[model samples]
Target: MRAMDEATVRHVARLARLELTEADVRRFAADMSKITDFVSALREVDVQGAEMTLHPIANRNQWREDEAQPGFKREDAVSNAADSEQNFFKVPPVIE
Candidate 1:
């Protein structure tokens, strides 16, 4: 793998809106190089005829009895809010 250059680092810093110092840029270059090397090594792994696995443990959707359950009161739900009216919590207007 090719070594990470200063131009590439500067370009990335600009895109990420990062204000990196000269020392930070040098350190980041080294770290990014190591990460690239690790990814390159991963590319060498053979996974021919391998089935994709989402989780290691066997899992199934557990069903429960659908019954009416008592829940928290409306007053309790808005108790912690800064502003509330008519049993509803008030929030800042999202649209002008």
Candidate 2:
């Protein structure tokens, strides 16, 4: 079984841009260790003829057919806009 240490957990947290307190780090370390142990146990399974599947039951893809449709006209669309220009929505600059 794997044992994920506090130092490893803190390092990973930093890499993922997470801000964890000391208590969080210690708590997560023990949880992560157990998770790793479970995954390690799964690696010892024997499945010589097992078929890979995303779910236990068979699945099917359901999709709607794509179709073109008429949309709002430019004049009528922008009529209610508080501010617009040349058939386009306009707003103040977000960045310099």
Candidate 3:
């Protein structure tokens, strides 16, 4: 893997719409080089027998027993809205 140079860092900054100074370019170049080296080193690790999984531990959603409950009236639901039309809350129209 090639080390990240200041020119590459400057080019990347331009692509990202960033305005970086010479000092920032130097810092970023070194940081990016270190990151690339670390990622390259990771390629040396072997995981041939490892099992693939979405998460490290098994997980599942828990649900409580369903039961009927009292509900709010339509008037109560729309009472706090800034504006309302009939039984529903009214909102400003959006135009594109």
Candidate 4:
């Protein structure tokens, strides 16, 4: 990979729908170049036997068994609604 340049930075900004000034573009190019260099350095590391983990530390998930439960009655559920029809809440139209 090559270091990020002014043209590449401008292209990326255009693709992202950003409007950047010349000074901003120059600053971003330098920042992006540093990031690219860091990533290139990381590619040189040897990790053939390293285990992939989602997090830095090991954690156990707390799980619970699925169980059926009773639900509220239609009347009770719609009791607080300002308007309800056929056990469903009624709201003002959002679209024409």
Top candidate when judged by TM-score against the true structure: 2
Write the residue-wise lDDT of candidate 4 on 1-96 in tens digits: 787989999999999999999999999999999988888987888989988878988888987778867899998999999999999999999899
lDDT of each: 0.91, 0.88, 0.89, 0.92
TM-score of model number 1: 0.47
lDDT of 1 at 78: 88
Q: Which 10 residues in a row give candidate 4 its minimum summed lDDT?
A: 61-70
Report the C-alpha lDDT of model 2 over 1-96, residue by residue, as the tens digit: 668988899899999999999999999999999888888876789977987877988888977768767888998899888889998878899899
What digit string (tens of lDDT, one per residue) describes model 1 on residues 1-96? 988888899999999999999999999899999899778986788989988789998899998899978998999998898999998988899899
Tens-place lDDT digits, model 3, residues 1-96: 799999899889989999998889999999999999889986788978977788988899988779876899899999999999897989888775
Of the candidates numbered 1 and 4, which has the greater TM-score value?
1
Return the top candidate by lDDT.
4
Quality of model 2 by C-alpha lDDT: 0.88
- Provide the TM-score for each candidate, comma-separated: 0.47, 0.49, 0.45, 0.45
Return model 1's CA RMSD, one decimal: 6.2
The global Cα lDDT (0 to 1) of model 4 is 0.92
Better candidate number, 1 or 3, judged by TM-score: 1
Instruction: List clashing residue pairs in candidate 1.
Output: none
